[model samples]
Target: MRQTARPAHPHLLASPAFEELLGGGGGPATMSALRASERSWRLLVVRAVLDSAGSAPAGPLPPPADAWRLLARARTVAEEAVEELLAYPAVGVWAAHTLRRLRGTAEDEAPLWVHTGHLHAIAASAAVRAGLEFRTAVPVRRGWAVLPALGAMRVPEASEPSEWAVAEVVARADGVRVAGRGLAGPDWHPLTELRADGCTLLLDDSDPYRTLRTPAAAEPLDHAAEWQRLFGEAWEILCDTGTGVGSDTGTGTGSGTEEARALAAGLVSLVPRPRAERFRPHSASSGDAYGAALASVPDDGEQLASTLVHEFQHNKLSAFMHLFTLYADQGAARLYYAPWRDDPRPLGGLLQGVYAFFGVTGFWRRRGHHALGQFEFALWRSQTAYALRAIGGADGLTDLGERLVAELARRLEPLLDEPVGARARSAAELAAADHRATWRAHHLRPDPGAVRAHAEAWADGRPMPAAPSAFGLASDGSTIVPCAPARGFDTRAVLLRWLLADPAGFDGLRDDPGAVVSGARPEDVDLVTGRTAEALRAFRARVLGGDGDPETWVGLGLAARAEGDAAGEGLLARPHLAMAVHSELDGRADPLELGRALAVADGDSL
Candidate 1:
């Protein structure tokens, strides 16, 4: 058998103030509270460390084992001091406040400095407890004292010092040569020594955290002009190749570079369009680029610029639909398609004229298919019909249906003609027939009164009657009526009917009792009868203090009620009609429905 993780010991270590608050108790009852207090302290320390490290010089630290040992020793000392304050509640509170203050000070500084700062704070406090005055000082080596402090306390370091000697490097000049090793994947690392010339290059074999910070190499012009030139060069490269090539292969060959440079120049000269933006390109090898948002033209600018314009047109059309109609939020108004990254060949240019025809039809439908409901489905059919007309009768009409009829017709048209073009014309004629059918369907009118009633019911909680009015009859000839239950006993009866009549509705109640309760109106008694009996059973369980088996029966009654069942049968079967009898005897049944249900059920049982 697998062993379960051991629960945290409350007395092993905790803030003195916390122990005092719980009256110095170390029992299981206080375990959760102790754990919460410990968590708060840990969060405070972590935040402090992160804050202090921000201003520290960027470089690899001493081995992790050495640092961890130093911190662990300091924690032991703090724990002892807290334990000593168990008898003095006021002192314990003061110590906790002081610990929080020290944490704040450490975090406000560099995060890397926190370990050293904490050691100093603890040592000073210990000295004060031992009746010796201690003064704070800035140690010459900054964070170096932490290691020696751990050593003095006989704490063993866990990590090898050599493993932490990572370095980072950067490029300096055009002609400088450098050899790198082991610097793969997504982190920055130090390169080999810089050449006599200004060139700086990345080293392949170095620690990942190691980095070199150098001034950006001097250009012939100002910073703004240099960035502009670079942006132009990048843009030209992208436009010419129609791809994002920089993420792989590093630098391209001479001709490719020249083409890229030219493209960039053109990009810079073109006026910045309203929607287009710029962004820096990054490589997978550098983790710094992982979540960084680089400037770039929006909408994944890999497609031809014209495609961007087309997408903008779709956005505008969607906005207009939202402004003009009620069902605008139903679904996507248009689908955007782009050639697969590895394949740039346009769909319109492939498969001879068939592909071009399909593209035109798809685009046209996207632009004008504004009919709602089944009419939208018809418009889709029309597109298929157009395709079939172009193909001619090559296939059969055996699979003709409201959907895909045009495609089926187009396939059939090819069989009627040797030339694909003649087949295409035949398919087009069949498609036009479907399109006409769709147009006629779009003009069919719905009952205006029903629509208005639905709209009102949705917007405002108006209680609609079961029977339709005269206006509804005139508009739709026949209106489907819904059941509407009255207040109190009648509503309870209706609920019982629904529970027996619709099992699916009861299933929903089982899945989510809260939803059922929320949907019930104030006049509805079925849910109240179920819920009240449940509350009473719970109260009884608390009063009698027995095992959970009786609570299970109460839960079953609640489940039945949520499913719209009459709780009368369940309550009558139970032994506790004594409370119900007493409630009825006191005449409390007059105002409260729950009291009334209990009185009636109990009286019948008696």
Candidate 2:
């Protein structure tokens, strides 16, 4: 008897097949299932260029004529970089990274490179359009590079994804080759030093690089030793860590050098092909595997190992997503709170984040047992537990997503349930609560129509409904991102936290007054810090000066809410939560949270 399979959801049936399609997070690819993987992102350049040229973007500026020419040249170089990678064996990590770029709808806040994939397409396109020409020659260690420079024209940082359209270097029998026009060689009195491991780490602040991008440091790299040390360390750490996941680099393979070679080979084959493509995400000393192309390699070996695992997982998923259904169709686009990010993200972004961090949590979990000291062990264990539970908060997963999540949970069950010290537990709790609060604030949108009705009745002296149903979810999550990225979590909280500090820090605060209070009224700081009597005196002094600032408005609302004011509460809640959320890593909020509205705020803080 031939049994037919049960029907798929209507949305899934209606779902179009991926043809150079974007955004499954980093799932399986569609177009590359048949065509060469290299073509995916290059095609994306064509689509994006055409769309932008036709649409006339909303920004004040107009598109440059050279934009098309640059886009074309960048596409060619990006394809070549991919082709260079394809020389290795199977498993389309390059395709994975590239497709992720092609499909992602792109958060306006994200850098161009991250939005596109593998190559820094946006920057590269601009460079070519400006009449920049690149030469073809492999790079070597000993002598100065002979490549000629075009001029003093400033260029975008070649490290960012959409910004950079080609790898700085490609592998060859003699040495690693340097690519890109206006790329002055070392012998040509060049500020750009080409390293053998396939990167153009800036040696000095020359014309274009200085104007184009602000890298963390312009110090020269000790190319050979530095590269060897990082690779060896990363390889050794992976072999020692048990919980490491992914195909080539994730497993606990043989010796350090052996693992390093395999991992290096895989990276060169995929990910912008940089051993350390440091052109993107300039100043953050954290984690990143951009569109799964490049991994920001810091000096520390352990950090490098975890980074390798993290980015590699992105590489794997970016490809795997094309073949599988990890998230539901209808709800996949709904924004959710990702513990690691300050911003709200759709299902695909959320999944990529979770998957990447899963490797991090696992590295720490396993490292605790191997080479870690006592303090390190406890820290890693607690952090791992924090991430494990964080993963559970994700919604909109399909059956496959559930299975994957379940499997990861099973592996981490021991660590998740493991007992830890009080400090560790407190940190974890704070982290969990923080994320829950952020999610509530970002995802929830009160019923504007209902609120309007209640407000109108109040204004008209008409009867109002008793139930709070007037304030509920929005029909559409329109107000999710409401304002610009905050300069600080709360300009008010910044002052409060400072003032709340003991008398010992008073001198420091007084010395640097600008940062202490920021935009908040100093008197409001006093009131929040329990200097109420003084605050009252100060407030009265300036009470009739003029219309209040945004902070004053926020303050009035807060007092009203405390005294049981409904209209005031709704009116003020919007401003109260505006960039008011704090992160454990101070001065940093999740990028996903930027410009999004929040339904929740830590009220007590207010």
Candidate 3:
């Protein structure tokens, strides 16, 4: 036991020291050992080459051929060491540490680390390729961590490891501030002084991407010192200003005035000088926490300032509309083409007509104007209606509603007119004619007597006599009246039966043309006509199935004196017209088999 201990293997001799350097680790220890072995082997190879090269020749006479051979062997050993070192565990730990440090830097600084690290590696590789022996024992000095926060030194370069140059550049800019030693570590740059109004430029020592505030909306800065000073001044002013509604009165006047002035100045600075006329603080709505514009009235000068710009657009548009329609009010010769002012129903009709026209013309298929119509309709039906209801009635406001409706119609009409094709005009005409015919037939043309009788019967809580049957003649032979046979019928069938059975009866009943129809009184007829006109329009389009001018039916029924209790006679005449049209369009009368199948499919007891 006292005898000299056997010498440790050459590999084991270095293992413990290498492990300690690598920090005790499974992969890292092994890697460090391999690197140690490679370095030792390379050293041995170099030693052997030198030994074989013999003593240096006096006066360096003739280059030794053996020196070249030894040099080649040394090069091979160096290459092998490099390959082994790349796979070393210590290298992996070093790389991981570097990456962690890079990521921990400010977001803007992180990119600099990446680029600089790449450049450093490239420089080292070039030096090694040039046969410059790198001292791996001496660690490369870590450059200043504060470079990125100072908004300087964007990229790493071999000659300039220090980021002082970048910091100096930003320090000289206006409205920027630099704190601490620019070459210091992470804590050197602080964002505590950053403020919206104070700083026109900011070094943004704080992590740009990590801020909870919206980065897109944030103003960017260029000079550190200038931005810092600006930010501080703005913040101080804002803090000193009064924001309360009554701050301008009495004891608060001084403070309030200063606050108002500061706020006004801040707002002015935000708007471009060219658009200053359009900028107004009072009209703009404040944004929500997420930076979206909201409809709520703003309490702060900043919010009000933004809102003014938006409201200005609306005011401008309203003025434009007023000017565009000035000609319409000039004289009696003025063409009163404003649909909404004349009739509420016309607005919808015009919109539908314009939309259909554009669709047929295939012009600007996705135009914003076309989509706006739907929005306008929804606004009228929902928001406008609710608003009107809240205001009780529009009794004193004679033309307000009408004017709004007309403006909407006018905006849509131009879109339709731009196409200028037969189909477009036809669609528009049909829409207008349909609206007018429906109004006239349902609200204006019914017999006064019939309307009065119906109302009286309703007042007395009694039903009017049953409507006459389709085939029945009046007791006086003066008229024929057709009643609805079923709750719903093929409109074509109903029309044909009525027309054939009562062709002459309606004409006979027209002697006292002004008289109201039986069962309905005069005033009652007028009210019913007005109330049900829109419904009648729909019924005419879908049931009667006529392509002819709807006015013809109105005139015929009124002029022929068929608008009394005998009004049923006029109703019957519609079916004949429908049938004739259908026959002409399809070249056949109702197909019995097809009708029967349809009835069965519809679950009808036909």
Winner by lDDT: 2
Model 1 bad stretches (over 4 Å): 1-606
RMSD of 3: 32.7
Q: Per-residue lDDT for 1-606 in model 1, tens only?
A: 011343544333334322211111122222333333333333344334434434544333433233233333433545444222221111122223324444463122223333233333233323333333223321112212111111111111211332112211112232111112122322212222211121111111111111111101111111133234433343443334422111111111113333233222111111112223111121111111101111223323222222311221222222122222211121222111111111111222111122222322222222222211122123223443333342232222122111222433443233233222322333232223222221211221224454344334423544322222121111223322222212111222223323433446645555444345332332223233345455444533432342222222233333333344454223223212212222223422211222223223322211
Error of 2 at 205 (Å): 14
* Candidate order (TM-score): 2, 3, 1
The TM-score obtained by model 1 is 0.15
List, in order, the clash count of every candidate structure: 62, 43, 50
Tens digits of per-residue lDDT, candidate 3, 364-401, equal: 21111432222222222222222222222222222533
Output the TM-score of candidate 2: 0.44
The lDDT values for all models are 0.26, 0.37, 0.27
Flag the better candidate by TM-score, 2 or 3: 2
For lDDT, candidate 1 versus 3, the one ahead is: 3
TM-score of each: 0.15, 0.44, 0.16
RMSD of 1: 30.6
Which candidate would rank higher by lDDT, 1 or 2?
2
The 10 consecutive residues of candidate 3 with the worst lDDT sum are 285-294
Q: How many steric clashes does model 3 contain?
A: 50
